[model samples]
Target: MRRRRFVAAVLAGAGGTAALPNTAGSAAARPDSPARHATGHWQPRAPLPVGRGEVGTAALAGRLFVVGGTVQEGEASPLWASTAVHSYDPRRDRWSVHAPLPKPLTHVGVAASGGRLYAFGGFTDAVHLNPQPDAYAYDPRQDHWHRLPDMPTALGSIAVAAVHGRLHLIGGRDSHRIVTPHGSPVSLGFGTVSAHHVYEPGTDTYRQAPPLPGEARDHAGTAVLASRIHVVGGRVEDVGDNLTRHDVFDTRTQRWLRAAPLPAARSAGAAVVMNGCVIYAGGECRPGSSTDTFDDVTLYDPHLDRWKNLTALPGSRHGFGAAHLNGQAYFAGGSPTCGGGTSTDTFTLSLHH
Candidate 1:
């Protein structure tokens, strides 16, 4: 199947399209306070050596790492899962290729903990038809990858966060099956899952955590704030079924609480904690006639329970990588448009601004 058709089939599912509201600039502001936006501009950085999308990203040892994802060689070329891994040193503003993944995969959840990078479950092929439970850890000092225990359930597009020295693998999609096996048809069977599992690296054990409340979704943005895990905006089953629900899990209380919803519904965005706030940037949705990528950057103030706008991306992108290192947030290697387009552009916004 063609790249566009494959993406359409994966995102549209059966045969229906759902329209999303345009809420990019509709964040609710306090009546007593003026509308607020973060002060800064996205500045260009070193581009990726190879363009890709749906990559897993995390910061480890003062450097940002971009892991496995889908790669498209050209406009007409077929998309395939990639094993390429690259690390960027913001201090030097340079990118260096590191040891690649053991296998090609996309939509893998990545997190940094214990001086190492961990990769969670993801799709093993070009199409989002195969979900795997495999897990691995990367050590930058050794430039190697070590296989870890598999997750309890197979998943892709999961939200991963490291809190209290444990890795939390949150809601994702599973139970994938090809509906049309012949003739370049676009059809697939899959559903969102609310399975939540926590992994302890020290003991190499897994424990079941509370499943995500309200909705079972995938491609949600996640960040750790004051030991609380915040999961925001994702699709229920397909990109058209975007959601604005925000759920927070407090490590101390071991309970889930509803937080302020995202101003705009999105999926496949990057989330990071910066300046004591959760910053979500660059997601994709099928809101109108075509697949639309986002450049709208929004910041959530957990203390105030409010959201405000932030500096927009240099270009719209989705299925990309975002990590915070030093005092800046870095975004890299995502589709500039939507579907299967690829880009090598990298941009950064300072948290100190």
Candidate 2:
């Protein structure tokens, strides 16, 4: 009966996870992730209270928080690992269940400077084996969540961004993941990292930068225009490979540049910017195929650096929880099909171009 209601909503810890699969080759120069049309005006809100994937998203003020992930998998998988915490309030199109997360994580590295909400390092259960350097700090006006200061090593699929006010933790997959052979789930190899850190929340500190260019990635997706910090599309060297390779980073010349790739080639999607362009919505375009996710949505015109394939994600899924607030571009929970399935389906994108 629907995987027994996804194992009773994953053993009643409720609030999800599951949708891991990537590894695809043969499409060469990108651009082939399912394709449809019209997502150009987007607007369909109020849905997430459940249905999750490698979730982790942030945005303060106008609300849009959703953390941890893994709703369920197979082979006696046991709901993977989820520690729910939801929020969404685009001017009353509500959804709430906040305060949760001091444990259970899944490829975590969320961000929301100044107004609090920061939880880094993840994977405390399988799916790449344990790797958690606990770091938390949420305080939506005293809804509470503390514990910061951990993360000098021990990471998980990171790629968080906040810039200027600190909080830039690029590249990911450290402390090991992806080791198959003999017990073979069939992933010949693993381990990826290029370590780049910069936390600094008024002194919880972390400082190390400049080291991701030769190759090393994990669910990559980042955004912050002009002032630099792009890093797009991920999964390179055996996860089934996926990288159109477009890196930027330039917090005043910490250096690293090259853009205009990705006509199709995505990984762990949802790198927002909204209104002014530069987006990469709904991930996992190809890479060892997770039974087929990637419902396309690519647009980037950072003044013509080009890339366009607007709309497609009313279906096809992956570990969802993209960000951008106030002006739109929110895409909560995830997994419509592919690797695993989960969804609370909340969508909103307002860019009338």
Cα RMSD (angstroms) for every candidate in the order listed? 6.2, 20.6
Q: What range of 10 consecutive residues in model 1 has the weakest lDDT sum?
A: 12-21
Q: For candidate 2, give the lDDT of residue 155.
A: 77
Please write out the lDDT profile of model 2 over residues 292-311, one tens digit for every residue.
66778887755446677875
Q: lDDT value for candidate 2? A: 0.70
Which of the numbered candidates is closest to the native, going by highest TM-score?
1
- Of the candidates shown, which would achieve the greatest lDDT relative to the real structure? 1
The ten-residue window of minimal lDDT in model 2 covers: 1-10
Clashes of each: 0, 14
Error of 1 at 107 (Å): 0.5
lDDT of 1 by residue, 154-191 (tens): 88888999987899999887845455546655555467
Please provide TM-scores, in order, for all candidate models, with all chains considered together.
0.87, 0.30
Per-residue error for 34 in candidate 2, Å, reads 1.8
lDDT of each: 0.79, 0.70
TM for candidate 1 is 0.87
